[model samples]
Target: MSRSPKINTVNEAATKYQAAPNEEYQLVEQAHRGVPAGAFFDILGFSGLTKEELSGLLDVSFKTIQRYQNDGKKLNALNSEQLLKMITLYQKAEDVFGDLVSFNRWLRKPAIGLGNQHPLKYMQTPGGIDLIMDELRRIEFGALA
Candidate 1:
């Protein structure tokens, strides 16, 4: 693995928010009234996570998610935070893998470093996001086994 300062910089920026678990949510609340729901659609397509899985991650019913999509409504703070996390992770994955196809493939594949869980399976929680991000950091620094 070849490290890039840019990736490390992004990794550090992402890690800084780990302490304030609600910082992302708060930022959403403070920065914008809400995030456009279509952004969710875009991220879902990018992340390769199922709609149900993403709804679960946002703690929203699938039907509500559909409503947001159909109505073009803005997502609540919680959902915005969740979506932001997904987007950030997706961007980092793209940076690491050099393309969406490769990143999506890696996301679906089991990894020894992640205790045999596919990275996509870990997107439901903040800690799980951290695990994936940390794994990315390791790979970035050539620290992987």
Candidate 2:
């Protein structure tokens, strides 16, 4: 009489019970902890705004905008109104651009680099930074005026 093949139930159970841990899971989790500029660009692109157009709308220097994109500056400094406006503008841009990959690439590379002088550099203004801070607070708290 031929004997049936021996089944190693314990070995099978041990193999089944072993949990495969993903080493990169923690790194991926940490990477998403904060909003990076790439995410902002993605949002903006998805909404549909060109880098130049956005820079103009924000009243910030193009170089400054580039810095924000390259450095991953936090959006916490923007007011809710500004954020809303940005959202709207980005949506509009999306309608016009239609391709997110191209839009992101363009955002990373402005028409001009950081050497260009901004129009606002010559303006003598007081409390501008303070106003910006206030607006940022409003944006963060969802209290735009």
Best by lDDT: 1
Clashing pairs in 2: 47-90, 47-91, 47-94, 48-90, 48-93, 48-94, 49-93, 79-135, 80-139
Please provide, for model 1 over 27-57, each residue's C-alpha lDDT reduced to its tens digit, 9 standing for 90 to 100. Answer: 4553256666655555554465677877887
The true-versus-predicted C-alpha distance at residue 117 of model 1, in Å, is 1.5
The best candidate by TM-score is: 1
Candidate 1 differs from the real structure by a C-alpha RMSD in angstroms, to one decimal, of 9.3
Worst 10 residues of 1 by lDDT: 1-10
TM-score of each: 0.67, 0.29
- lDDT on C-alpha atoms for all candidate structures: 0.64, 0.36
Clashing pairs in model 1? none
Q: What local lDDT does model 1 show for residue 71?
A: 77
Q: Candidate 1 at residue 75, lDDT?
A: 85
lDDT of 2 at 7: 23
